[model samples]
Target: MDKFSDMTLFVSIVKNQGLAAAGRELGLSPATVTARLQALEDRYSVKLLNRSTRHISLTDAGAMYHQACLEIIDSVQETENLLQTGTKEVRGSLKISAPRDIGKQFISPLISEFADQYPDVVPYLYLNDNLSNLAESGLDIVIRYGELADSNLISRKLASSRRVLCASPDYLARKGTPITPQDLAHHDCLTMVRSNEELKTWHFQDSEQHNVITVVPKRCSDDGEVIRQWALDGAGIALKSILDVQEDIKQQRLVTLLNGYMKNFNASTSATGADLNVIYMSRQYQPKRIRLFVDYLIERFQQL
Candidate 1:
């Protein structure tokens, strides 16, 4: 039991990056955490961590030991989870991130229903338009606008949606719709800005040829919702995801443009699998609540 406690302490320190933070998280005092870590090192007769005044890092041996400890802890937790949760209620904290428009329009309502069904499961949703690193954000899921190339993560398509050019009917009526991709250079365009860079370049392809046009944007923002609202306000034409503006088009508030040309909504030259995806880490084990919630999201999105 002492050895197991030491292993837990070591992992906590590494994860928290300090003895004091680990102690706070684990409900222990800083001195207790320091003593337990020192005792583990003394028992092994080798230093596992290189600690500075403000930071801590694992030695090579400590890195290997941490990996082993993780495996052991995961196995034990799996066994305990299986024993305690046999045909029982699924309950856990589910942390998710998404774009602001989608979160408020779709995910937020579904989350309300989902929470009513599983009252014990807590949900946390972070809404921002800019792309985020799921691992660095400590979020369980990230809903993004496109597919990712990382093998460590899984990007699952939630809806069959594509990017299209659209703008408010009033804007198009005044600006007199662009005839070709080249004409966009002369028209007012709303674009997205990410990482302090303006995404003003647009890509279009038809069976005949591929074309790239760099439009001078009249307005730009980090939030897609802002750009969408601007386009609705007759600020300029916008290249947007179909799922986002479908209702607006149906209501005749916005009109789809350049139907003959398929515009690539991605910022880059290449296209990703989908315009929107629900991404999570690819792991051997996932909590039942997360699995159920993801499945529920898939089911609800399919209804759209």
Candidate 2:
């Protein structure tokens, strides 16, 4: 008898509580089911099931083996599903949400590439600085930076970037570089206001001690790009992501300040640190388009 077939019969017997019931469900005779189970036991040289007039139960080893068999069966089914649906032409609308800066700088290009690869897939990309609920927003996926608060959404880490304190070379030359967190009070801090009610607070570490300092901004705006541009134009010092300002720093357009004191800040404010993640909802089964897009994003981010 096939080993897999015998294992299936054994599992069905346990689930149905008897060989007769399992045989009825499987459209086989009770004697055939019993024979299959006995063959499996003989192959393993262990008695798997304890039979009684009124009840059936598994031995200790049988329970462990049953769980393993179930997992293997599940994996086989999943693999078959992937093979059958993997190359099916993905034609559908996919809605994605991301923060404004990341959306424009990174996600937009990814979407364009994804659309080109699967021409039938239409993408609706929403870019906003404000927090938007994925389910309520009707999004297929959300690219979030930093910590997330929702426990229901499934998140996959894509990449990581550090938030660093930066200023233009000219601004630093005029104001002088701050060596300590305390010196930020004397500097012209350019703050990025997230929302109407949000306050801009900067975090730093000194001698392994952490501090959260609220800066009285010399210039403030809700737009991150605006503050970043202002810093580039030598208006004031701004805290920004390393990835966002990497080229500028490389070109000496902007210079990092208070390097020893700078630490990662949680952009979402719910957590203490930041991580770039791709979040999606749990379903009975994920569609091909959703899986493909997420895999593509992860691959692209990993390459970066």
Candidate 3:
């Protein structure tokens, strides 16, 4: 039996979740896939999977072996890609995930420009604020903001955007502009919500002081774009990324408030890191397509 071939087949079976599905992916019949799996188990003298009529699951030993197989397969593929000349002419499907507001306003244009430069490469963009499963979703990279909760993934800083406290001129005219962090108690603040829960706490900081203020939410949404729209519509004050609201501030549509107290607040509703980042799983070798895309993003975002 070819152990490497079986390892590839086994990993595909797990990812695809069935023998027939794995067979379809590998261009083999279900019988052939089953035969190869049996050969692998026999060679090792241990059952690697628990199979029923309708489904299959990995055994404890199978889970451990699958991780080792992934590393080995990745190394071999990297070696093969390294031997291929003309890495400069990148060509392949590149899948990426990014936040909705940034993705539409910034990343979509970047992808279009990159595609124009490298017409041979295809791009797929998935927009969501939720953290994605990279390996399971087969994503090449994810552009994230603020602190990452998952420590297993690799992250690189792309750029940083300062946080700002701002309100529309109309709203400030109606409710009065706040001059200090403590004055937020009297204003209606448009808050950000995640998973149906409103994030009511806002953090502010200066050289000598740090203040945490809990405000009543006038409106809230899981989408950052929605919250931004609310602020633009003169709903109430909001803490927002300078990148997202820079044009509005420049146009005087929104007035930045409590500037003296916002030096270190970092725009995140929670006091987490607010640097924009591009993240991916640690790999033995990154494909040229993925590497080129990352470099292109860094170049474009640095200009912003």
Best by lDDT: 1
Which residue pairs collide, candidate 3?
Answer: none
Question: What order do you get sorting by lDDT, best first?
Answer: 1, 3, 2
**Global lDDT scores for all candidate models:** 0.80, 0.76, 0.79
lDDT of 1 by residue, 170-271 (tens): 998788889899989888999898889998878887768878898998998988889899999999999888888889899999998888876875434344
What is the C-alpha lDDT profile of model 3 across 1-304, one tens digit per residue? 5788888898889877788999999899999999999888888899888899887777867765765676677666656655785344567678889877888899999999999988978999988777665554456789977777666578887878667888899998899988788898899888877666677878787778678888888887777788788899999988787777888889998888888765333344443477788997676556677788899999988898
Off by over 4 Å in 1: 1-87, 266-272
10 residues in a row with least lDDT, candidate 1: 265-274
Error of 3 at 221 (Å): 1.3
Using all chains and alpha carbons, the TM-scores for the candidates as numbered come to 0.78, 0.67, 0.74
Give candidate 2's TM-score.
0.67
lDDT per residue as tens, model 2, 134-251: 4434467888766767776688987777678899989988989987877888898888666574345777766667878777788887666777899999998888877677888999
lDDT of 3 at 37: 91
